[model samples]
Target: MSNASFWKGVLPAITTPFHADGSVDHAFLAKHAVQLVDAGSTAIVPLGSLGEAATLSFDEKVAIVATLVKAVGDRVPVVPGIAALSTEEAVKLAQAVKAAGAGGLMVLPVYVYTSDWHEAAAHARAVLGATDLPCILYNNPVAYRTDILPAQIAQLAGEFANLQAVKESSGEIRRFAAIKELLGDRLVLLVGMDDAIVEGLAMGAEGWIAGLVNAYPVESVQLFELARDGGYAASAELYNWFLPLLRLDTVPKFVQLIKLVQAKVGLGSETVRAPRLVVEGAERADALAIIDHAIATKKA
Candidate 1:
């Protein structure tokens, strides 16, 4: 595939399904991948933060990507996340996922390390060099506490031909304009946050690296298309209705909240790994209420 516009559009950062005992549910994972494609997802991104990549074992990550690739049958791209704390680990991850049949990777910065832009650039170089597959550099300063600045990204783009896009989740929509001004057509910009899509797209974001798409794939797909196709009025209408549920993607308990919504929609189980429990009490009630309200008031 060509580098241009191939990585553009709605790519859902899919959740990793776990069994009651917290084991990786490979069977259901394949089924879920197929379901996402059928629901109109442009591509599938497994093993992302939404998928709890930090908690998964190496073997499990490979299996998940392999299962997703087999299930999707190349109907859409399957890009898994590569989040590592060291250059060696990240390179290993990129190589392993490429071997597992992933079309590309959503590469995040070194987690928990708080590296500066130069260190981030070096990390990207090592990881991008390890695999020939296309990559989307994830820049979520809010979550990772390290900014992958526009200048650094432009430098990486100049050095690595396979660095095709950026998941711009800085929560400042104006960063889109800054990156666009600097990189121009060098990198396709994808909005990373769920709540920021409406304005982000308005600010020249080419697509969405969405989190809530796991539970509401149809709406997510439609939202991206409407916005990209110049249907801003319609997209904004849908986005406003989706705002309440989209806000759930930004919270500390987002994994639990999204899993609960997915279960409510009959997509998957609400089981999370140890140290991260399923949503309960007022949090669960609030999530349920938002979901129910959105469902009841949904419009085309």
Candidate 2:
């Protein structure tokens, strides 16, 4: 399928669900993908930052994509994030997931190493050219120290036909307008940060690579539709109540926080992989306050 307009709605940057044994939970994984799509998510983005991509092994990541593909049934795109410490590994996974039935790919900066545009370009170029699958460039300067500026995004967009979108997660609303000013719809611009969704949309972002969506897919989509159709003022009340919980997606411990919310709503468990533990102590208490409050007073 073509990548045009692929970034049109809330594409969940889903959290990885782990079993009590710490194995990937394929059963819940499949069920969750279909549920999100049915709730109005435009696509399924697995093995992303929100999915705890760093902790996953290569084979585990591929299997997750395969499970999501089988679950979604080609109804919506399954765009797995292609990220590895090495360009070769990233390219290898990109091809594997493409064969596994991924509709598209989201290219991320190489793990753990920050680099200049020259280095970043080479890595992105390798992955973008790896497969002809439509690609979305994942730009989160905060998480991955490498920042692909708007002009650099234009550079890649100009060179790669498959690189059709940019997930702008710089946490600055101006980046959205900047990308639009330079690319002018050449690349579908999407907000990668949850707290900035409204501002990003106000600045011409067509979609959101949403984190909070995994817990509240219905509300996330409803909010997106409301804001998209009726503007910010119309969506303020709901967005206001949702804001406290949405901020959880911006923190470093976001994966655990989002998973906790998912667990609270009975959508999934709060388990996470090693190198990262589930939120505990005071963090869990504070997070639950927000999660429970939102659930208590939620609106469509």
Candidate 3:
């Protein structure tokens, strides 16, 4: 896909809805993909952080991608996450994901083991080199610990034409300006952090790979359009209300929290895989309060 064709607007990283038995509910997963597009998402991203990519096996990831491809089927593009613990693993998975009919890849850094700029760049190169599909380097220093800095991102973008975008999740909005100054349209910037969406768009980010969109895709798409269309006054009004829920995306239990909201809105279940539990207690109460308040005070 061309840069202009695939790399703009709200691309919600959708969750992999699982059955009560913890296996992926492929039927519901496909249904959710269509709903996100219907709800105004420009594209669908499966196996992303919100989808709990780390918890899925290689075959499971491919199956999820195939299911999404069949569901969305020319309606919108499906970009699956390329997350792994090593360069070779990521490249291998990228190859499989491409074969599964994904339109693009969101390449994340080597998980767990912190990598320096060169290692991070090499990891990106390996995956981009292995795939024919366009790739977006996920620069999430806060969660991944490996900061793919502006210099590194510029280097990769310059080296690989396919490395056309970066999901900037550094949480510092100034980094967006710095990146734009350096790359200056060479790389499409997608705000990876949900809380930074409005400022990121205001600063010239072309898209958002949002987690909150998994639950509130309609509002997420509306916010991105409002900001992109220069309706700042209205966007700010909506964003202020969204801020409380958007903040949940930055929390450690964001997967659980987002899934909880998804169930609350009648989209999907809150059934996460092992090692992570569903959002409950004060966290669940807090999230529900925000969702309820947003509904009660929704603007016409």
Off by over 4 Å in 2: 1-3
Q: Write the per-residue lDDT of candidate 1 for residues 153-252, one digit (tens) a residue.
A: 8888989899999999888888899999998988888988999887888888877878888888888888888877775686878888888989989988
Residue pairs in clash, model 2: none
Q: Which residue pairs collide, candidate 3?
A: none
- Sort the predicted structures by TM-score, highest score first: 2, 3, 1
Tens digits of per-residue lDDT for model 2 on 71-110? 9947988999999999999999999999999989999999
Residue 128 deviation, candidate 3, in Å?
Answer: 0.9
Candidate 3 per-residue C-alpha lDDT over 169-198 given as tens digits, one digit per residue, 9 for 90 to 100: 989898888899998988889999888888
Q: Clashing residue pairs in candidate 1, if any?
A: none
Cα-based lDDT at residue 150, candidate 3: 84
* Candidate order by decreasing lDDT: 2, 3, 1
After superposition, the stretches of candidate 1 with alpha carbons farther than 4 Å from their true spots are none
Better of 1 and 2 by lDDT: 2
